[model samples]
Target: MIRRTTAAKGLALAAVLSLGLAACSSDGGEAGGGETTDTNGNEETSAEPLTIGTILPVTGTLAFLGPPEIAGVGLAVEHINEAGGVLGNEVSVEWGDSGDTTDYSVANSTATDLINKGVSAVIGAASSGVSLAVVDTFAEAGVMQISPANTATDLSGYGPFFARTAPPDTVQGAALGSLILDGGHCRVGFLVQNEAYGTGLRDNVQQAVEAGGCEVVYGGTGGGQEFAPGETNFGAQVTDLLAQEPDAISIIAFEETVAIVNELVAQGWDFNGTTYFCDGNLSNYGDDFDPGTLEGVQGTLPGAQADEAFREELNTWYTENEGGELADYSYAAESYDATILAALAAVRGGATDGQTIADNIRAVSGSEGGTEVSTFEEGVAALEAGEEIRYVGQSGIGPLNEDNDPSSAFIGIYTYGADNTYTYERQIEGSI
Candidate 1:
């Protein structure tokens, strides 16, 4: 679901079979919307408008993530406005680019700018590193910050004002471990980045594998690149992976995926026999590599694979409004849910400040005995009608536990195909 703006390997691609196979399948619950009015019965605004700002990457290494995430925000805004904007004030969005983690200044300045503008809540900074850089700023400013794609386990204890719709890497890693075992793979080796996201995930995956009486082939070998062009060589890392002689290798990286995959193939390693990837590099590789190079390759992404109908609808909307089709929808559902939760929190609290929304967020996302709703209009109406509302939207958000993370989630398992593209294979349902 992602594309990097880099050059491809020059080797002749394997002849593709069944190129563009059957459209991928997905999973998620659905609901309908109806008329809605604020609890105050006042459809008009008497207070300062509620402004939600986004720090998603519009021009960075993760810029490919921008379109779907940004579009998700836009769609939520449209839906919320149609349902009656939060607190009777028409909701509006302030846009800012989180140029990636290459520079903290860009993220810091942008976070400061959004805080200075008195944003009630913030939506992104897709990279966990980018979010970490500016999270404290948003927290100090008392603004609710939610990330759609950050999965680092370290972010679990972020302050009360911080939460994310996406589950942590711990959940994903453990699920992926179970997946490997279920697939008859026991000797899984991880060639992961040496950082919070990678280490956290690696630890979880190791724990799960070891718990299942399995062993990690190379449990501690760091495979991260220096994140620099020309210097971001993965030959040594690939050599290390081969040295471990792991039955399966799971790669965790960003733009460096191109080189790592190339190295694996160039060295005569079986490209699809035992290679795996995580969210950061689990993207459509139809252009980056040979046509059928990734056929039979597998990976895990953090959220549910959205259903085809919704995907088509989203792609259509994006083309009509945002200039192109949504190539990647990995975090789109989470982005939409995050925005909706923040707005619902504001509406429920009847205030527009961060702390108030923070206090009420969990309440609107009811944990027990609440009416299940999927849209803002339905949730708002349910709240007004004095019925407990539980919002299970596009991504199927589970209970936001006390740690501000999901108590349960659906980790999508995907498999690459003849065209170097992937389709959903199944889902691993997990919980605390």
Candidate 2:
């Protein structure tokens, strides 16, 4: 069975009955409930309200991703509340900043504050390295940590309390590797970040590319050629990589991509379909480069492209609530799905605690056969009708597997135009 435990359902019923009795007798309108075990095996009240905290990149290297991700979470919260919330109480969210890996202080302190605030789950730290820094803190506190955009392979099965809506690097890596090979590039060079996310993804891409009869001429995994996170200057790295005279080069870093691109251009490297990008470094370079600077370059990002209706909704919601327009939609769908899945798990397990969510998330994600649902309200209605519901949300990810990663997902391929902005070319589906 996908559900790890059967005890939560009975406990949830008991808590509901207890609350009912308390509501009938109490003058202050406070409800009573039974205690349950958290992920850390500590006793906690089952009647606690569900409060999710976000540790997303509000500042630092990945700041460009903040707007859409935050909007996705906010929209999910709005939809959940409109559906009468989980366990008969409205869901609440706390926001915090998860700066990039360059400064662990931001993520650590944010994780500390969110945990101290009694958040049942945390949905953030988009960068895998940032998550690696704070995941243990949340895990030890019995708080579920679900990332919307973490793809490092090492994070799979990191802990029972750790889950992510994003598929692992295995899926994206294979897609990107196949794309590069299909371009007829047999010699590839990498400019990977020397961190968990970068190295892990680089390894997967290397394997896929090599399997397709290609050679990594430079900067493959463990070649001691990766640049440090937050590296400002890449002249040396770019020069060394280009010295190999490879037919193709892949840049696997975050904000440092701008510097790398500048160095590549300065060294007379062509971006005309020869350069590839992964999710981390793929962004609108219109502001950073002149027209046609990145023309024909291609990149891959995980998650299905948001449809026009969803994009408009996200834009409207963000503009109204956040006073900003949604720019990048990279992990927005994944973020929305992550939030909804966590909420449904809470409902299914009948508790607003992390352990219960961990126990039931997979089942709600359709690891076991169930009625398909697309919205929070539909899912709630199905669960209320005594049916197990499989939530197929905006991201279009497959069911959560035993490793807590999506079993299958879509990888979006994009190509840059003359304006240095990327357009979705197509999607490749992969199973992990």
Determine the C-alpha RMSD for candidate 1 after optimal superposition of all C-alphas.
8.2
lDDT per residue, candidate 2, 1-432, as tens digits?
000011223223543342211101001111344454332234444656688888887667787777788778878887887777777667777777787889899789889988887789989879999999999999999999999999999999999999999999999999999999999999999999899999999999999999998899999977999888999998888888888989999999999999888989899999998999999988887878978989999999999999999998888877776555776788999999999999988877778889988998999999986999999999877876778878999998999999999999999999999999999999988999
Candidate 1 worst ten-residue window by lDDT: 20-29
> Where does candidate 1 stray beyond 4 Å?
1-46, 219-231
Judged by whole-model lDDT over C-alpha atoms, candidate 1 comes out at: 0.74
TM-score of each: 0.86, 0.90
Per-candidate clash tally: 0, 0
lDDT of each: 0.74, 0.84
The number of the candidate with the highest lDDT is: 2
